[model samples]
Target: MHIKPIKTEADHRAALARIDELWEAEPNTPEGDELEVLVTLVDAYEETHFPIDVPDPIEAIRFRMEQQGLEDKDLVAFLGQRSRVTEVMNRKRGLSITMIRKLHEGLKIPLECLVKEYQLVK
Candidate 1:
């Protein structure tokens, strides 16, 4: 086991290659242990160097709406009235805490996506 911290892009690439090689490693074995450790190190390195931003709250909502074949009218139960839903979908309004909770509960949109700070259209 020659594991090292993935500090550079080259190191990241090598770790990924190693992960591919170990993709079929059997569990409870030395090879699998190495694979797990390498994957953790690579994940930590990528999280620092190649951080991914959370999706915009409205966009997340829109994506879920699309996935579930829902129209704006369907969001009224979570977002309030039709006008409020339109305001939210148009980016003219920000989600209130209550709306965020309702959306998470009713639509199963991730709270992380719903709670992210997003710019409202002026």
Candidate 2:
């Protein structure tokens, strides 16, 4: 098993191809070990070169609300009042730190996701 650090795009591609070839490798075998190491290297390379942005805070909230089958009115418990929930959902108001904490605690949303900056409408 020839393994190396995934340092460049070409190296990343080659590692990916090898991982695909070893996709069905049985655990505790040489091929499986290679696959695991290549996956870790590819993940590290992607994290550095193709970092993903956190979702917009409002969008994350909306997505969670949808997943929970919740309505705007349901957000009052986390966001405060009906009007505030409307303002937040409409991007007419920015989320305060307190509100972010409440949303994170009450909805099980990640603090990072809830605290991401988003545009406010005029």
Candidate 3:
């Protein structure tokens, strides 16, 4: 169990390779523990060096809609009337606090994903 902190791309790659080797290691054993720690180290390194941007608010809504097999009309309850739904989905309108809360609660979309800053057509 010679685990090392992943500080560079080389270290990250090595950790990933080790994780692959230990993928089937029995849990709670030495190899399994090493795999778990290496995964955490690699994840932290990637998060900082390869940070992922948050999805646009409208995109998040559309993704959630797709996941739930929903269409524009389905969002009318959370977004208001049919026209409002179209406007929001079309990026013609910004999502208000009320709409954010409703979407988060009703569609099970993460609040962090829904609250991301997004441009709206003037």
Largest TM-score belongs to which candidate?
A: 3
Instruction: List candidate 1 segments past 4 Å from native.
Output: none
Q: Tens digits of per-residue lDDT for model 3 on 1-122?
A: 89878888899889888999999999899998998898889889999999998798888888888888999999989999999999998899999999999999999888898888888887
Candidate 2 vs candidate 3: the TM-score winner is 3
- Per-residue alpha-carbon lDDT of model 1 for 14-36, expressed as tens digits? 99999999999998899999999
Over 1-122, each residue of candidate 2 has an lDDT whose tens digit, in order, gives 99999888899999999999999999889998998998999999999999998899999999999999999999998889999999999999999989998898888889889877788999
Clashing pairs in 3: none
Candidate 2 runs further than 4 Å off: none
Q: How close is candidate 2 to the true structure, as a TM-score?
A: 0.89
What is the full ranking by lDDT, best candidate first? 1, 2, 3
Cα-based lDDT for every prediction: 0.92, 0.92, 0.90
Sort order, TM-score high to low? 3, 1, 2
